[model samples]
Target: MSKHVDLPDLIPVFPLPGALLLPRARMPLHIFEPRYLAMIDDALGTKERLIGMIQPNEVPGKKAGGVHRIGCVGRITQFSETEDGRYMITLTGLSRYRARDEVEGFTPYRRFNVNWDGFDGDMGPTERDTGFDRPKFLDLLGRFFSARELNTDWDTLKEADDELLINSLSMLLDFEPEDKQALLEAPSLSTRRETLVTLIEFALRSDGSGDMMQ
Candidate 1:
């Protein structure tokens, strides 16, 4: 979807730390909770068909950032219902939104008043440093994945466009929730790629400074 979606004032949010959706990327979700199932059902019935993916703070008593102030908005592009009554769906990201306020809702799920002004650049690639050290990034990725004793098809990994690569890695890797959110909130695709590579490099360092204490 090349066109930016008209921002919505309120959206049903799925709060799961470590799960992220970037504009134009697709995130598959399995919905079994009664409230979320209802949320999906309502989305499927609506013309907009959107869901917000946000991370909540894991630290006990940190309610302020518990449900992050920002999130990505995605439209349901595919949907299926299981015999077990769960909903399987794929959300194609539209844009990132900031949660401005929580509005009272009649449904079991909660809704948030969101603002998209901050994410105007999400529609497409913006002017970014195109020469941000791809070789070093790939090299660090090699070391990081190798240390974990994992193998990847370097051929495929090399072919994905930078945005896909950055967002995909940011989602697939075991970065802390805040770290992942940092990647999500990166100012530009270029910055996100740099941040991702730096995070990997830090993780590979023997001293393990990448360890952010929860």
Candidate 2:
């Protein structure tokens, strides 16, 4: 089944070159670039302050901020203009999209023509019995804290629901650009959860930070 939605003609987006937004996750961004400032301006002038969150391929070049194919569209749930004209906005992701074409801009930002006519992706089942040998996903998180010697409240960490747990882990993990892009491009939530588990397991075996494999 496909979940078809009427996307706005002009969606405000912030391009984060290497990061991906899983469905239903909230990404808080600090907007400082001039082009993005123009984007915020354009969005605030319209009814929907929805911005597509996409990642650039590399940095420090003319097209340094060129984006990946897939990205998530998010609504500005919380925002405030800073004293220095920067926008601190929290984006609540609504759906993912594939870039159709690129738009030329005089500013330092890039925009894409998105195709989101039929968005069918869903967060799959998370309660299935895998019957694996390793500890629960929450325990792996605890192991991550201990292995990295980082301090966090384990009780709260353990209490987070599966979606929150996985999304939070994805945001905090040190994943490669392509690996992170793969996670973003995952068709469903269960797949992203599984990928995070695999990443955690790999990190456990390789002394803390290790390469994330697809």
Candidate 3:
């Protein structure tokens, strides 16, 4: 089965570094900055609150650098206005895109013309642990936490479904920017799971591994 959606040529893009959003995951964004606030207004006015969440290849404040080629488009599904003049919005991932051209304009926030050429649409099938090795992964997390005396909600974690379980674990585990990017850019659930395994193993060998894990 194929899943498809029409993608516009001009789309509002938010280039936020160090923030990674996976498919089927809800990312809550607090729009406080003036530029981003303007972005929200534009999106709302058009009734097309579709924004591509991309990361800067370099630091954010150093005059926005080029963004990663691959990014996901999120739609504003939930929003709220706060008393302090900020917007709390939760974006749900819809599809992935490739940046075709960067739009140069007077807008403070960035915008881009994108190409959805190779987007496969649907969130691929859930990957089952091929080695039946979840036990080892579980053990590593437990020991990794005990060694650091870290406080974690084991009960809640155990109750989560596969997608939530992996995503939550990825966020809680100490992964480098590059490692996190790898997970974000992973095209399939199986690949992301593999990356998580490697990260967990690396954390066990590093000093004060908690710092290196998160």
Candidate 4:
């Protein structure tokens, strides 16, 4: 993260269910909706080119889902417009924020007033997971993937550093929205790793029982 770059108090938010973007990670997004396409265009014109990635909460009585309080702010690092007028963009996570309030706006997409108090650490170096048990975690991951029949580059995953490996899995895994939110809200990398392990274990235990572990 650049020391000179300042995060905006107000930012456009993309409420995607089950999407997780952590600091120092990159997320590729395909923007086909008119509102989000407009958001991409507007973001490109800004200096920071920032957009907040948040998950929607499933409200029982509400017709539309409510946005989660916590989210990650990412800068538009790579972008290209397709022939069909859709956008293919990659966002590099900068910091995590807590939404203070939703700002009523005329822009098709939602915007929020966010606070970046406890997440200053997110702007720093990649967090080191001191207690990360690589062998154990990888073994669990392999079984979990096998049960789900999900294919991955084992060599690349083995070669990845602690932060990269954990964050990448947290993003790539087919966890439920609530599980992803829990992982996103985890205060430390180690905590997130533990939460991930638990989620995977639960999925594996529930596999083929028709219980449909989220």
Name the lDDT value of residue 131 in candidate 3: 43
Model 2: worst 10 consecutive residues (lDDT sum)? 124-133
TM-score-best of 3 and 4:
4
- TM-score to native of every candidate shown: 0.88, 0.79, 0.82, 0.94
Candidate 2 regions with alpha-carbon error over 4 angstroms = 1-6, 9-12, 58-65, 106-108, 121-135, 208-214
RMSD of each: 3.9, 4.4, 3.9, 3.0
Better of 2 and 4 by TM-score: 4
lDDT of 4 by residue, 19-131 (tens): 99999999999999999999999999999999999999878988675888999999999999899999999999999999888888689999999999888789998899998
TM-score winner: 4
For model 2, the local distance difference test gives 0.68
Report residue 189 deviation for candidate 1 (angstroms): 1.0
The C-alpha lDDT values of all candidates are 0.81, 0.68, 0.73, 0.90
lDDT of 1 by residue, 1-214 (tens): 2454566698998899789888878999999999999899888888889999999865676655458887898999998889999988999888888997887759898789988876776776533458656666777777778777778888888887777777878888888888899988998888888788778777777545343211
TM-score for model 1?
A: 0.88
- TM-score attained by model 2: 0.79
Error of 1 at 55 (Å): 0.6
lDDT of 4 at 186: 96
Lowest summed lDDT window (length 10), candidate 4:
205-214
Q: What value does the lDDT take at residue 126 in candidate 4?
A: 82
* Residue pairs with backbone atoms closer than 3 Å in model 1 (clashes): 57-66
Off by over 4 Å in 3: 1-5, 59-64, 121-132, 147-149, 171-174, 208-214
